[model samples]
Structures are given as structure tokens and as C-alpha cells.
Target: MKNLNVKNFRDIKGYVNHEGLVMKARMIYRGGPLNGLSEKEKKLIEKDLNIKYILDFRDEQEAQLMPDCSFDNIVYERIGALIGSFKHQGFDFGNLLQGKMTEDKLHFLLDYIKDGYKHMAFDNPAYHRLFVLLLKNDGGVYFHCSAGKDRTGVAAFLIMMALDMNEEDAIQEYLLSNEYLKESNDTLCEQLQIPFELRKNVNLYSMFKKSLLI
Candidate 1:
């Protein structure tokens, strides 16, 4: 699962559940978009990982703009877990890039993300379908959003909980994305010319801190 050319890609195997049982390796994976996967990478994912289902949490516009690389025998589904007007739920990175991230805007964005997490956790059809797919499919299920950190993170948390993983363990798993995506995030900060002091807040926009879970 490591060095697979996909951002934030990792096998959910080896994590201990509440029963103190480790999850089977290669049975589930999570990551970012699969748009630019190479042939070799696709073969690795198909033949090695055995991913049978790909559940995308991105909205229609996001998927259309950068569709996933299709694999034979894999079922693909797009379920926008946000469940609202895309524009309203979406974060405006352009504003951040333009140095418009004031304290008020930062607070607003944090509240928005926290609200989004709540929505995904409760009464969200996308997560409902996700559980259905998990039950129906014995093979691997690879689920992701644009960055695999918000909607995708919540989905991962739910799945771990269903497997009887503890609250703290599930939160730890969700926070791993910040580590996995560090390189990409740093590159993004460089591109946006974010000051060292502002980079932490900017990263918070897409990251899942333990505080957010609480």
C-alpha cells in the first residue's frame, strides 16, 4: 500500500479493533483521488490490493472535473456525503491563496468543517450507502474524497467503529491523514506563499486534529 503513487494511500489493515483483533491487511484502503494513476499503479491496485469497490465522497462537479481511473471488476460510486449546495459546503482555497484568511474567516472555516463532520456522522445517506457496501462486499473497499481527510475521514471513523474500534483509536486513524499528506500539504503551502505562522491554520482547514473529534 505504501509508495502507490496515490496521495494519503494506506491499507487499514493491522489496526486493532475494540475486540483487540487486528484488521486483515489489504482488505480496505483509503486515499485521495485516483485520476492520474498509471497503468502499473492500476495493476498494483487491482491485482495486489484487490479493491472491489471505490466510494467517492466528492460532489458531482469535483468528480466530473477529475474522474477516477477505472479498473475492471471494480464497482465505482459517487456519494456526496456533504449533502448540500456544493458551493456553500465547499472551502474557497482561492481566498486562502490570496491571503484573505483573517481570524474571523479562520473561525468560520473551522465551524464549517466541524458542522460538516457532524452532518456526515448523523443522518447522512452517503455513509448509509457506505455501510451497505461494506456489508455486501467481501473484497477491498477504497473510499476517498478530494483530500481523503474530511468526508473520507469520517467514513473511516465510522467503519472502524462498526468493527468495534474505540473512539480514541478511531480518532487516531482519522488524524493519520495529516502525516500522510504532509509533503503535499507543504508543497501547497509553498505554492500559496503562506507564512510560517499562517501555515498551521491553513493546514487545519483540511486536517483532522484530535480536538476536532472531541
Candidate 2:
């Protein structure tokens, strides 16, 4: 698991639930898109992680643009977790690239993200299927979206809560993506030439901690 090139990759093992029961290791992993994994990295994911299922939360357009690398014995399922919501509204990253992400637009984007989280938590059929998949399969299940910070993070929060982990613990786990993706996010902001003021207001690559209130 160490030295894997996949961004935000981590296991949910060893997390203690509210009852003080430890989560089993290697059974559940979360990370960013798997489209650009190296041969060595693929080997590690396939052999070391023994991942049998990949629950992709990316929309169809996102998947089409950058499809995941195929692996032996892995069943991949794509669920557009935000299909009807902000997926169509399209928060323009071009604004960020041009240093034009105003505070008003940033707040609007945060609202959209928060709404998306609520939809995923309450109304999305994808999560129901996810729980069913987890209940039936005992093998490693790897789930992710583009950055693995928003949709995938919410999924992780739901999963932890479903396992009887406390809400605070689940929220903390959701926020861990910010820490894990800091290097990549910093590099991205630098490359995109995002303004220091905008970066100060929000992380373009992260989920808001307040979004978990849902």
C-alpha cells in the first residue's frame, strides 16, 4: 500500500467504531481515479490489496474522459452520484485556472457541493447499491471518484456510520482527504496559478468540513 502512486489512496482498516470494535484492514480502500496507474502500482493494487470490486462514483462524462485502468478479477461499476445535480450545472474550473473564482462564486460552489452531499446521503440509489455490495462481498472493495475528496469522501462517511462508527469519527475520516491530498492540491493550485486570496478562502481540491453536517 505504501509507495503506491495513486492519489489519496488509503485503507479504512483499524478504525474503531462507537462500540470500540476495530474495522478490518484491506477490506475497504478509497482513493482518486485509477486511470493512470503504473504497471507496478497496478500490481500492488491487484496483489497486495486483493481488490475485487471498484465502485467508481464518477459521472459518465468524467469516466469517458479518463477511464480507469483495467485489472484482472476486478469488477468495476460506475455510478454517477451527482448525475442530476451539479453534474449538469457544471462548476467551471476554467474560472479557477484564470484566477477568476470570486468569493460569491466560491460560496455558490460550496452550496452546490453541500447539496450534492445531501442528495448522495439521502436520495441517491448508488449508496443503497453500495451497501448491498458491501454486505454481499467480503473481499476488498475500492471506491473512488475524480479527486476522491467529495463524492468518495461522502461515501466513506456513510460507510463508517453504517458500521456504527460515531458521527464525529466519520466526519474526521471524511476530512482526512484534505491532509492526504495536500501535496497534489498545492501542486495543482500552483500550476493553475490560482490566486492566493482564493486559495485562502477555499481549497479547490478538497471537501468542506461543514458539508458533513448532512
Q: Tens digits of per-residue lDDT for model 2 on 4-83?
A: 87778899888888789999988888988898888998888888887888988887778887799999878899987773
Per-residue alpha-carbon lDDT of candidate 1 for residues 75-190, written as tens digits (9 for 90 to 100): 89998877433336464455544655466766766666656555557778888888888887688899998888777887888889889977787878887888888988788777
User: Compared to the true structure, candidate 2 yields what TM-score?
Assistant: 0.88
In candidate 1, which residue ranges exceed 4 Å CA deviation?
A: 84-87, 91-97, 202-214
Worst 10 residues of 1 by lDDT: 204-213
Residue pairs that clash (backbone atoms under 3 angstroms), model 2: none
lDDT for every model? Answer: 0.76, 0.76
* Residue 98, candidate 1: alpha-carbon lDDT: 65
| lDDT (C-alpha) at residue 78 in model 2 | 93
Give all TM-scores, in the order shown: 0.88, 0.88
Off by over 4 Å in 2: 91-99, 204-209
Write down the lDDT that model 1 would get: 0.76
